[model samples]
Target: MSDSIVSLHEPGRAVLPAYVRALEAGWSPNTMRDVAPEQLAAIAADPDAFLFGLNGRGGKIRLHDGSEVDRLPGIIRWIIAARGPESQFVGSINLRWQEDASGKPITELPPHVLGHVGYTILPDHAGRGYASAALAAVLGEARTIGLPFVRITCDADNAASRRIIEKNGGRFVESFVAPFYGPGERLMYRIDLQS
Candidate 1:
């Protein structure tokens, strides 16, 4: 478990020494069946390497040893350092978007948007509103960056996950079956930043 303060910055060499031992708490969550946390050092070395196949969002999810990490499809992960003498990282939120409506590929980004609420807090960090706080902070960044909306998703059976989405002003969009990574059905949520 990490005990250092949380700071938002590009993952540098500073990340290796930060999360090498974070195996137990996040690797195997209380409810999630197929996710695992990664060794911090490995992720810091290769930020893009963490992104796995699409869980939703038509993109991909970052994974370290089967657990999910926040991925930045827009910018890079603005590493959130925990606040305290405790060497803990709450969660990472990123600003990015899906490939344009046409898969033909375009150079410029689409409409106004900052980061998507990529992933929430690890299992051990749940119940403290860290997920909410991290989400709020991400929305704030979108506002500062002048975006119109943000999107997020969670498993349908995950009550805690639904709460996190709702707490951040997420509206129930629709529940659908995920194709790529499937242990079960996933619930997708959306929030209009302008609303």
Candidate 2:
């Protein structure tokens, strides 16, 4: 089945069950940390609120260190779902950016965040071109949202992820360790949406 990016909060999209299963099986939407257990518990407590909160519309974000901070402006999330009679959650993708005094989006991300876009696909659904397709779609969204470009990062050792970024027109920028994402040799890439 083909995959497409869908709204995380779509009323007709019943994504929680598949999402929960992925978390239970040790898959995390965020690659920076292992917070799936906490997230799963939160989802179990209130499914609707949990789904609605994925886009950071709640205005606050809890960090892996258990600290809460105001959500960054222009943060949005979408589910990567397999399309068919029964669409299933294969993964999630998100975009975040800082805002100016007038609330316009900026390319600068928060100090702790390593990239403008981040995504993770379930282990079972890997190697199917889903991440590539999703990144391409989100780059279009980025352009529509007035971003001239987007920066994305993946672990340097993660060849598959690196390939996905390059396939989406990502140009390698640098290699460094992102302390916020823990210890790892991370490679940064930029996709110029204006092109």
For all candidates in order, the CA lDDT equals 0.52, 0.76
Cα lDDT of candidate 2 equals 0.76
Model 2 lDDT tens row, 1-195: 122534343322365677788889999887767879988898879877776676445377777777878877554444555555766677777777777788677898877888889888888878877788877877777887788899999889999999999999999999998676678798999999986
Clashes of 1: 16
Residue 194 Cα positional deviation in candidate 2, in Å, after optimal superposition: 0.7
lDDT of 1: 0.52
Predicted candidate 1 versus true structure: per-residue lDDT over 22-128, tens digit per residue = 33344422122334344334455564454322112344344433544443345434345575555455544455654445533222342222125565455556676
Best by lDDT: 2
The TM-score of candidate 2 is 0.86
